[model samples]
Target: MLFRHFYNRLPLQLLSIRKHFLTNKQNYTVIKNTQTYHNYNIIPDVFDEAPNEPLIIQFKNGIEVDYGNILQPKDVLEPPIIQWEHDAKKYYTLCMLDVDLPTRLEPILRSFQLWFVGNILGQNYMETGETYANYIGIGPPKNTGYHRYVIFVCEQKNKIDYSPLIKGDLMLPRYRNHFNYKEFSKQYNLGIPIAGNFFLAQYDETVPKVYKKLNNLSLFVTPLK
Candidate 1:
């Protein structure tokens, strides 16, 4: 019982140990919330794994989302400031999409790209990446219910060459609708996202107008049977 005796002799260390255990427990709770993403079929329906780490996202309107927290459409109208742990020397692809674009259950327009930035130096997307598509926030049509907005950070192999996809001095796919990230990633050799985060937003007064800000196409659909 030497260890017991040592622990009894150091109340402060025991307290520290207890505190550390609770901190880890809280972190685990946060990580476990990814189960909701899986439960919604967002896991296999899109990628294979639940994200391994946290990706922090905060909006200009003071909304911070990490674990699919439900946020007001008005608050996230603009692009969020995203940050995640990364290798400063490596490149990354930043992307955000609406997994439940038309409706939560039947999103025919699922994974409509809201933003895309290629070859960002680490997490510095603002200054380093070629912005193929500028940011557009949630615009889930009225009564379509809450939509999951997933932002993923894909670590890339090297500086991405845009010439292959560029046309008319700009990136192709002028409209953000109907994107296929898996194919795009394979084409560019971007491995699955190492880290990610998400938020939930429902249709609001701001949503009807949000579509007007995007590249070209927009949706206003009736739910399917």
Candidate 2:
């Protein structure tokens, strides 16, 4: 004679098993199914860890851009540096060091460059204008490594018409020969480059949108441990 044992609810038993597996953090392993596996102790948690201060960007030209002031959440305004100390104190917990480039910070720097370039062109709508979409390359080219971050405070020869295509907007093949670097130097009347540079900035993972909007400016906060 054959005998069998049955459970009242097999599905419910399996559901509870899955729930327990998910909820029990200590029982999980990287190689649970392996016959031989190694388990290591997890690192202890740390809170409010301070990152290396004064994040530095070393340009290919050997210049560095340092954010002159520490970054805070309040620095999101038109003149972010006005209440620097107070905001830093209040939001120190939220602040993190600005470190290497991340995908999130790319857009912020692009936006900043768009505005800076637009300001050169005497237009405020550069953000929404086709200028940003047309002119800017997404990131530096391969094998070029990291490009130098240079700030140009230039005065144009004529008030650039926002409607016409910008000089930088032309395709590399077509306009590469016509950039007129000499004319740019003559029109703008630039002096010898400054000796050193710095900018103070902060970043927070919680505020991703701020990074997206201001990525062009190269503002970012490094993630904490």
Candidate 3:
């Protein structure tokens, strides 16, 4: 009964035990809070698996076409010699879209068919495919912001007819704005693009007159916008 007598004579270490437990509890709460903050700031790598192929387009002037590069309408009035490494197994159709330069009068952005030549052996554009729509010179209104002109080279599933569009009278006002390049490609049996590029162009005084003349062509046909 000596141990029982010592227990009754001594105060138990309950306060010391409670203090140790509380310290550990606070440390654990701090660690959990820090871990949650760390997780919130972490960003996962999502685009690591994406394709890194480059689509290159250059002008005769030796200047490479890039997005946001300032250029004039006359500079590209004549089509640029477009180049892209093809998948030797299949021939592709070359489609170009001149995404319109927005004007104060018409703030809604639109795109027009600059060139929609299809069918070709290799890259011999002059030798093949129906030249459905001819290239139209850029004519953004004076003071309008730069226009984005995009060129898309798409894959052809089969030979497609562009006769209905080509044979019709080409008018600017009718076909100028709101041309859906992607839809047109789909309608013609052309699938996703093999390659693409774009450049920018701003407006000048002659733009209005040029657009008017384009609209007033004698062989004008009511465009299916």
Candidate 4:
């Protein structure tokens, strides 16, 4: 009876030991699996549907501009215009401008330009030029009569501080005293390029040639006075 009792206790002890060993192994395996999963499964290689282009918004009055493509004073110029500015106080800044494109087309145009500039030109406007009187002309399809008025907001690769002065040459020297080229270059090199751009196109309403083809069509029918 004593031998049988001892034998039974021995088996129980061995079973307990085996249970403890298996539990510890399972815990270790769980820890190892967690680490492996975090290292291999959770890390992302690229952003998921991240913005491939800048954000563009248009305001009422047919003016289109983007805000994401802002250029600091150190971008490249070979790629062309990066940002835009307009003199009309009503639509001067991004905050002030109101969207004018067709409801369905507004978002499309904005996104298209944002992606187009971001991928192709690699730059965008950082700040709006402060010259209130600046204006540029846009001719017809071939520079014909009654040209269109275009306001351009060009982005420069260098930082400019146009304070106190109202109007001057659009060259860097005009604002050289206010800019820090060394610091500007450091920031410029790190810049992702202009992230916003805009343009305002206004046409003459009274020009007869504006709708000459339409007028010819009307000649074939009864014209509305």
Candidate order, TM-score descending? 1, 3, 2, 4
- Comparing candidate 2 with candidate 4, which one achieves the higher lDDT? 2
lDDT value, candidate 1, whole model: 0.74
Question: What are the per-model C-alpha RMSD values against the true structure?
Answer: 5.0, 22.1, 19.6, 22.2
In lDDT terms, which candidate is top?
1
Residues 119-148, candidate 1: write the lDDT tens digits. Answer: 899778999888977776677777777888
Q: lDDT, candidate 3, residue 164?
A: 63
Winner on lDDT between 2 and 3 is 3
Writing each residue's lDDT as its tens digit, candidate 2 over 1-225 gives 122233434578786887798986433532231111111100001111111122233333333444332333233222111111111111110111111123222422221231123222222222322232222212222222222222222223333343343455333322212222233334444222111122333343324443344342233323322
TM match of model 1 to true structure: 0.79
User: What would the TM-score be for candidate 3 when compared with the true structure?
Assistant: 0.62
TM-score of candidate 2 against the unseen true structure: 0.26
lDDT at 165, model 1: 49
Give the lowest summed-lDDT range of ten residues in model 4.
111-120
lDDT, candidate 2, equals: 0.27
Error of 1 at 102 (Å): 1.2
* Model 1: colliding residue pairs: none
Model 2 misplacement above 4 A: 1-67, 79-100, 103-114, 117-152, 162-198, 211-225
The lDDT per prediction is: 0.74, 0.27, 0.56, 0.26
| Model 4, runs deviating above 4 Å | 1-52, 61-160, 163-192, 198-203, 206-225
lDDT of 3 by residue, 1-225 (tens): 998887666655865666788878846644553343233211111011111222476655766775346777766666677777675546677766555435423435455566767776567777765676666656665555666666767667766666666534555555545566546656876545655556677766445545665774223322112
